[model samples]
Target: MAFSSGSTGGPMANINVTPLVDVMLVLLIIFMMTAPMMSYPIDIDLPQRSLNPPQNLKDPPPPISLRIDASGQVYWNNSPTPISALRNMMETEVQRDVNNQPTLEIDVNEDADYGLLAKVLASAKNAQMQKIGFVKK
Candidate 1:
C-alpha cells in the first residue's frame, strides 16, 4: 500500500484493487453470515461392513536402469544394447507383468547424443511404457 501526501494524480497507471477487495470481503462476510442460518435437517444412513477376506497385494517390480553413453551406445542394466532393439525391449519388459510394469530410469552421459535420446523416448512411447524416469549421474 502506498500513501502519498503530495497529490500528482494524472491518470494513474497502476491498478487499485481496494474496491475489489472490499467487495470480496463484503461477499465473504455475507456468505459466512448466511451459511449457518439455512441448514436443513437431513439423515444419513451409513451401510454396514460385510465380512470378506482381503485380497493379497503384489509388490511392484524393480526399476530398470537404461543408460546411454557418450559414444551413442545404449546399455540395459549395464549391458551393451543396440538402439534398434529399444522398442522390443520396452515392450517385453512392459509385457513381463501387465499389472505392474517396471519403471525405466535413464542415466545418460553428459555427452550422450540427443538424437539417440529422442529415439529412445520415441520407442518408449511406442511401447506404451507407463513410467519412465531420469537418474542423475
Candidate 2:
C-alpha cells in the first residue's frame, strides 16, 4: 500500500488484481497439465471393407412390387397375397439370396387404409428387409 504525496487526498484504496491473475494462471496450468490424461484411447473393431459394392460395378436386383389397393387388399407381384403370407414371402426371398437382398417397392393407393400400410411395413421390417421404397403413383 502507498500513500499519496499530493495535498488533495490522503491514501488511495485500489484493487490489487495481480494475485487474482496469478491464481488464474496457476489454475489454467493445472487444467492444461491434467486435460490430456483425462482422455483414454478406445479400441473398436471397425469394418475394414464395405459390404455393399459400387453401384456401377454390378446390376441391382429387380425390386419386388407390393401394392395396396383401396379395398385394403395387398398384392405381391400383381397377385393377391394375404397379409399373413407377407412375412413368409419376404423371408423366403431373403433366404434365396443371402448376399444380395431384393428391394421392396411399395405402391399404396391414396384411399388405402393407413393401418394396412403400417402393418405391411411392420411385417417387412420384422423380416429384416432393409431396402423398402414407396411409389408416388
Candidate 3:
C-alpha cells in the first residue's frame, strides 16, 4: 500500500523546529555574551567592632520647644516671638528655675527658612544653653 500526501497547500508535513531552536540558541548565546558586561558588580567591606561591652549614656529628656513656622517666624514654646527679643527671652528661660534642668528643643516646619533656624540655633548656643536639638514638625 502507498500513502498519498494531503491536498491544497501541497503535501502536509510535520514542521521541523530545528531552525527555530537554532535561532533561539543563537539569541540566548548573544544575550549570555552581553549580560556579564551589562551588569557591574560592587564589592564592599564593612567595618567590624571589637567584642566589648557598650558604654551606657543617659539620653536627655524632651527639651523646651521652640517652633519656627514657614514664614521665618519664631515661636517661643508655641507662642510667636520676635527675633530681636528671642535671645534675651531664651536666656531668661534657660535661667528660669535653676533646678529646671536647662535644655532647648527647637522644632522647625519644613518650609521654615533655614537661615532663621541657624540664627535660632546660634542664639541658643550663645546663651550657653548646653543641650539643643531640632525637631521637624
Per-candidate local distance difference test: 0.88, 0.90, 0.75
The sequence of per-residue lDDT tens digits that candidate 1 reaches over residues 36-66 is: 9999988965657869744765788989899
**Tens-digit lDDT track of model 2 for 1-137:** 76778886878677788999999999999999999999999996564887885575456678899999999999999999999999999999878775678899999999999999999999998888877899986
Candidate whose TM-score is highest: 1
Q: For model 3, how does the per-residue alpha-carbon lDDT over 1-137 read when each residue is reduced to its tens digit?
A: 23336466455455778899999999999999999899978986565886984476355444677888889888877788898888897788667644444577788889978889889888877776766766654
Clashes of 3: 0
Task: Check candidate 2 and list the clashing pairs.
Answer: none
Tell me which residue pairs clash in candidate 1. Answer: none
Where does candidate 3 stray beyond 4 Å? 1-62, 97-100
Model 2: residues with Cα > 4 Å off, grouped in runs: 1-58
User: What's the TM-score of every candidate structure?
Assistant: 0.59, 0.58, 0.50
Candidate 1, residue 44: Cα displacement in angstroms equals 37
Model 1 regions more than 4 Å off: 1-55
Clash count in backbone of candidate 1: 0
Measured with C-alpha atoms, the lDDT of residue 5 in candidate 1 is 50
